[model samples]
Target: MIVTSFFSLFISQTVFAKNMYRWIDDKGRIHYSETVLPKDINYRRESLNKAASVKEVVEEAKTKEEQEMEKRLVRLRRDQEKIITRQKVYDNALLNTYHSKADLMMAIKSKMDAFETQNQVVEGNLIRLKQELEAQQKNAAEMDRNAQKVPKKLLDGIKSTQKQIQELHIAINEQKEKQSQIKREDEADIARFLFLTQSLTEKRKGTSIPSIKEANELGLFYCENDRQCNKAWEIARTFVEYYSTTPPDVYNDKLIMNRPPATDTDISLSLSKIPLTDDESQLFLDVHCRESSLGKDLCVSQKVKDIRATFIPYVNDALSRTAQ
Candidate 1:
């Protein structure tokens, strides 16, 4: 009987330990047992620990799978980020190499307009001067041919006209010098402008990538290479210096001609009347001849006749001093 009772007690304890309960006492201390606790005791179900619970085995497997999936997603995100960064770098390099070709063409057009307008101004002045010089020559020739036959008052008029002719010649030459000087300055400006534009074109044509070393050194945004950064700076500098003087918008407009104070009234008025044409060569020649003939100190008579013959309409009212 004693051995049987001992075996029964051992069996009961093993069963109790297998189905445990957890409770907290009024004092907040936790207790664990196999039997049901009193009603006053607040009981809670206990979660399994890795060392003591079978549920822990299943939970561990789920946790491991979740961790592996998270790792794969993180890797995929990192790879995608790398691809985006590389593509951005290449795009920036391409951007550094060019302005839009259309923009360059527009700039060229503006330059051409300015050139044409300036040349027109010069041509107009020349045409007017030619007309006046011819009239002066014709008057002087008439006076010389009929000197003895003229009255005393008319003789004085002939001498006065001759003096005016001499003065006109001096004025014409001075105008020529000023015009030549302006042309030289304008040429320089145009050359520098063209150089900057062509540089952009050449850079676009080449396939060279920006230098990484340069970009790292500069630490500037969009600077894939040193050359790009440098070129950008240069373009900015040119714009500030040149474009500021005559803004592109203003330069593109038809130029307003301002005649010099010393310009002959007849010549100035006549030139102002002639309209400009699109042909640059003819315009250039007209400008050169007009500005030059006015300033010529030698043979004003010959120049006056020559220019009058070239543009005959300018001298239609040759002797009219009012120039209308």
Candidate 2:
């Protein structure tokens, strides 16, 4: 019985020794053994065959912080993907909705006209209701002067008229809000349409140097290649941020811009990276002011002209420095 038990122990030892397990301990020391311990199971490990070649590798379990960071990265990527998808949908709708800027303007005008007509009707009704309310109030006051009890019907009419006035006021306010919202939406659509169509049209025109007047009007900076444009884009971004009175808004590879001007004097700046060819691009700077006469004047002022004039030189100097 003793001999048989010894033989069995030898066989088990030989079988276990056929493969080796290598792992790192908590102290980051490497260890190799014929068998892995339960305590070392969570550590990153490798299994080697009899030839001493790695047969399998197991990654270490992530810590709590590592796991949380991974989850956050995943969520960020998902949100970015959602934004991209939504933008594509909007672009498609904008392209399909109108053939040109004129069409878009016409559509906007029609909608505004309808709203204006509705508001006029509401105003007329409000005037009539107020006159009626005034007459009812006078009748009530006369009854009170005579020391007569005002009828319940008259009192109820006064209350009803007051309630109608309150409701009409709310409706008028809501209508005005709607008109403002419509204007904003239409403006956005127009801007996007102009960008999409203009970029395509300009790309077909090929790269060319514009005249001083054209450059000032368009705020254009030409680049001969992708490398130059990439460098120029960064410089253009700084220029936009520095000159724009409004806070930053949308930023992406193709466009960088600030929020629309809130006051007549405030200037909003934008840069569009338009592809001229497979290897060439142009950075276009645009200045915007509030949608008022004063704002229009501000956009054409010397201050704005100076801003546009510097765009090309600013980018050129930046590129020259980088080249050096």
Candidate 3:
């Protein structure tokens, strides 16, 4: 009977060895493992431990491959968020930097100038490649067509022409790929430059006068009279920014008052009134002519005369509006 009990105990231990390990972590969470829990752990053993319940914990004990995959997934999500945020910042910079049409126009012009210069070099390479390819193709076609009529003495010449044709196609393809690569690089550079420029422009807007009304309160009139003139100055500033300099006289001339040519001393008669020069008026008109009668050609004599006649009435009318 003692021998029989010994055999039964041995069988029970063998069956228990096939089951999983179970334990609770420091955080009060249960865990399971195929291996026994270490004695160094502080957790109290549970009386309710069952092999079936601990099976789930053992299943969750991730392999190295699974752990690495999970880490990669987490990193991918984080990287995607960073990419989205970066794109948003780039877009916002473009929007906030270009406060005026003139500033945007200048930026565009600068981009075009740089792009055009580089494109010329690319174009030259492309043209050369195309010409060589065409010449090779023509030679090949002529050789192939003549092969049937030609003697064996010229067979080597035909083979040489075929080889030249193959080489030409390879050269053409290489040049084309190079051109494409250059174009992509150029586009990326242009995009980066635009983003930087836009950010700078937006930052500049913060330091500038906020609005026409605020400018009028400060007595910084550039053309016209009172608040209208102040508003015109804001518009003019935008144009100057875009153009990268003062606009042409034609645009600026429109803002001048029709005064008979005054000598320097005549212009100094009124202490309170700062006389507006024709050039100054022209600058204002060029920068801010959204409603001028002569359109963009206002600097022409006939257009100027027409604009002056129409503008004087409008300015007088605008003065009354300002007081209200």
* Each candidate structure's count of clashing pairs: 10, 0, 8
* Candidate No. with top lDDT: 2
Write down the lDDT of every candidate, Cα atoms only.
Answer: 0.42, 0.86, 0.47
Q: Per-residue lDDT for 32-109 in model 1, tens only?
A: 445554563334445333233423111212357778998999999999999999866754543454355455456556
CA deviation > 4 Å runs, candidate 3? 1-153, 201-324
Best by TM-score: 2
Q: Model 2, stretches more than 4 Å misplaced?
A: 1-26, 32-36, 45-57, 198-324
TM-score of each: 0.21, 0.54, 0.26
Query: For model 3, how does the per-residue alpha-carbon lDDT over 130-163 read when each residue is reduced to its tens digit?
Result: 6665665566568778884544645665566566
Please give me the total number of clashing residue pairs in predicted model 1. Answer: 10
Clashes of 3: 8
At residue 285, candidate 3 shows an lDDT of 26
RMSD of each: 35.3, 17.0, 25.0
